[model samples]
Target: MREVAFIKQNKEKWLEFEQAIFGNLKKNPDDLASLYIHLVNDLSYAQTYYPKSKTVVYLNHLASQTYQKIYKTKREDTNKLIYFFKTEVPLLVYQYRRYVLYAFLIFGILTAIGVISARNDDTFVRLILGDSYVNMSLENIKDGNPVAVYKSGSNWGSFVGITFNNLRVGALSYFFGIFLGFGTFYILIINCIKIGTFQYLFYKENVFWESVRGIWIHGSMEIFAMVIEAAAGFALGASILFPNTFSRLNSFKIGFKNTFKIFLSTMPFTLMAGFLEGFITRYSIDMPHFLSVFIILSTLSAISYYYLIYPFKVHKKINLKNT
Candidate 1:
């Protein structure tokens, strides 16, 4: 094909590849493989048919820059991973923290409302929780057990099912962010409401503490994973809303890429939450109160440390090195 015709025929693909390589450069500046491939292609095409053209000059410049970048591949990889942990993850944590604060605040305010309404009208719990769940819990409470629900499912079956279900929910929450952020917010709102109402139902039975100890053992990880998923959603949405220096399409592409990483990070947490809910929660009633409290606090601390504190520390270290 003639040079112009070749350029015309493959222009779209070239542009797409250019954008992809450019985006990766911002995140992984020393990704030599991509840089090399892109540079070689552009250089070969330009040198072959556009020897005296301005495009040839541009291609040479880009190729030289890519070669320099390739030399720092090791440094770049390390910096990128550090940057992701520190800068990227922490920002996500901050967003998640905001969402959590909002979720809890809304939950607390609604619980107060539920309590007030329940006091004024005995049937309020029924309206919120439905009569069946309330009745079953009441019976369990009377029998000196406030959290019999955890024991209802078969152990092995519950573990597999709950784990699969929670992972699916987390994945969906992340995936739905493709619609921007509304889909993620919707997931957070629904779960917050369910948790609040569920807590209120137990509060009605005067077993709120018991319920919290039993439920939050697993709920901490599950809910936190959900929040991370929401952050992923926000990431996806932000790409569309604020591309910053990048084009909107480029932004969306990057956002989805980061969100996918975040989703992958939450898998182990989902499994842990499922294990706690399916197996550990049932035994909480049988275990000593102090032991249960310790387990809950320790898990919370670990989650907070890894997702919150660790990222910040990593970020600071990276920033210092970069500076």
Candidate 2:
């Protein structure tokens, strides 16, 4: 048959094949096996009837790829896990570094602005933190404790509560990417400003180093996760703005998948941050200086190694392999 004649004769079958491949067909194991058989038959028909047509060419390619995947499912499963860690995770970490740098730069500038404003005005902390919170902190500081707020709840309760809250925030930060990433940016800016203002308050009280050592014991992990969340948001946003070779819908689907992976990756860090904040921050003043420094340094080191060093190492290995 001629290409046009073949397409017209088998158009319904082609539609069914397309639906099976990309539509919501709800395939059980038996149904999946039947669908694969149908796909193979359709490809055979297209090859026989319209060998030179684009439809035939595409169907041939699709059938070949699908057959390989279906036949090697068990083998691919193991390789896919290895591929995710060695390739996908490292690339994600690398993308997050750019977002981290952006967040840091913005926060640093805001911090400088906060410090300048605080130095020039006596009530800047009260303005930034609200009068009530400042009063409470001042009272706590007067009692020789600056971070007593975290110690109010039972440790286990605090851990569960704080972990749940952080997870919610991280999930929201990711889900908002469905709105094209504006929500993530909004959250990031608000958090960054709060940190800047909060730190300036400590600086104003001449307790900057003490506050840094206290807060950053957990803040390093918490803040890095936030930046990673923002990077996921960027991926979602960029998928919409620049679909590249893929259709907009396809790009968005891929972007959402990547972003979801990144969101999942932040869970452990979120829990660790919660633990430090709820349990460790309360005793910062009592903890040995070396221990506090060590926690902070260790947290930073882990961030550097995971996001920067490890990713570069993986990329270098991949490049060497390709060469």
Candidate 3:
């Protein structure tokens, strides 16, 4: 329908809602909630069909007010955590998948910069990955054991330390979203550049395939989860930066809840990555080529399906249920 016709259709109900809130047309909390849900359904339709219409803005404002009223008197769902993972997080991922895509793009571009810079300037590798790591890799390469660094530590020790560090990085990536998301961007810059330079260092030594054989044993999940965490950070920052019709504080609460759920969702992947790094990666060179590829592909596929494919499926299911 045209925007004008759409508004005309809902304008009377809109005025009724305004009066309900402003003129104190008393209603039970559950009734207010029922109204809120129906309003959101309308708002969702407006967003999909008449996104640029002022009707969407008006509906969003009205829905948010209803939300606030309902929430103030709402009872907590005891299965909230389970519900969050099964429904809420998937919906949020579908909603903010663009942020995730942006994270991947940022990572790719910065990594490409690192690779190009390292290829052009010998010092670029040292600058990005640091002299100590670059020198160590070079020494290991000269020793014909380019990825020996993966074997330097004990499995359990590496597992604990690596997992701990990855969690810290993940938390920082998500928390930094508070700084208008530059925090996550900066984190991505550092890591992606380092990855590019480090990979190029192997490439320079002509151990590119050999390096890939080892690094990807765990790097697939490790890297993918980090990128996802960065996306969560961006989503968090975006909530604060663009509150839409909601109050800034309310938007932040929504953003914080959403980002935290997304961030928490990555924990299993991060721990699995650490496990692969600790127990599995050390043997990457000795493992059969097929086995290495299997581990990498399986991890990559699992994360890819969950993040990329599963959300769309969940969205369709939700849509079907709502319909």
Candidate 4:
């Protein structure tokens, strides 16, 4: 069907939905849910046939509002926290998967820049990482304990400090989305550059594997969570930049609520990373290669599955049920 005809056919129903949604018309919970299902069907159709049209964007916005309304109307007697992780966060992640891709792509580019700059400019590493840290790392390398920095603090102290610091970084990466995401991008760039340079330093000292075994024991989850937090920030910014059918303020409110949930989802992974860093990373030098590799790969795999693979599964399940 032509876009105009499609809109002509459904516009009245949509307007009625708008009335029902905003409380201009009375709607029972089941009635609103049925209407929401119809709206979703329309949304799916628009996505398929008029993907680039304003009609599609409008339908998406309407569908989101309806979904929220349905949830509000029918409060399930379930654990809110468990439902958040199991259903809500996964759906949000799937909805904003593109932003996550963009964040990772940006991270890759910035990291490459760091690697190339560190390789070409002799002073670049020290400039980015600081001279004192560089000197200390070099001495540690000489002492054949290349990642000995992990051993500096007691386990509990390091765990608390590292967790707090990581949480702080994640929060900044999220809240900085208020600046149209540039602030979040800056945060990501700084961290990825430092990471690239730090890794390159290890490669330079012929202890690349040593660095990986020590750092990635926790770095796997830590770094991945940071990228995801950045993705949430991007979503928040996009909400402001393109409000679709919503007022800019309303768009921002929805975006902040959804994206903030996504940010919160990363907390457990970050905490686990901190635990591994404080307790296990300090023993990396004497740890067996296979064990270290397993820990690193396991943490990376767990996080990767949650953010990348599991969201699709949940999305599919929901779609199937709705269909």
TM-score of each: 0.69, 0.71, 0.84, 0.93
Q: What's the residue-level lDDT of 49 in candidate 1?
A: 80
Q: Pick the candidate with the highest lDDT.
A: 4
Writing each residue's lDDT as its tens digit, candidate 2 over 1-323 gives: 66677667867765555455445554454555566677667667777776776777556534533433343342345676566555667765554456556655655665577667667888776777899998887777778667667778888888789888878877777777667667776766566667777877776677778788788988888877777776677667766776643478966875676667767777778889989888888788889999999999998788757765887787566435423
lDDT of 1 by residue, 248-297 (tens): 98768756765676677777788999998888998888889998899888
Q: lDDT rank, highest first?
A: 4, 3, 2, 1
Name every residue pair that clashes in candidate 1.
none
Native-to-model Cα distance after best TM-score fit, residue 117 in candidate 4, in Å: 0.5
* Highest-TM-score candidate: 4
Superposed model 4: Cα runs more than 4 Å off: 15-26, 51-54, 68-77
Clashes of each: 0, 0, 0, 0
116 in model 3: Cα distance from truth in Å? 0.7
RMSD of each: 10.9, 9.2, 4.4, 2.0
| Of candidates 4 and 3, the better by lDDT | 4
In model 2, which residue pairs have backbone atoms overlapping below 3 Å? none
Minimal lDDT window, size 10, model 3: 64-73
For candidate 3, give the lDDT of residue 24.
58
lDDT: the better of candidates 1 and 2: 2
Q: lDDT per residue, candidate 4, 1-323, as tens digits? A: 99999999998899888788753699998999989888998899999999999998788767766776777668689688887888778888988999999999999999999999999999999999999999999999999999999999799999999999999999999999989999899999899999999999999999999999999999999999999999999999998998876689878887898899999999999999999999999999999999999999999999999999999998788668777
Better of 2 and 4 by lDDT: 4
Which residue pairs show collisions in model 4?
none
Model 1 misplaced regions, further than 4 Å? 1-124
Residue 66 lDDT in candidate 1: 48
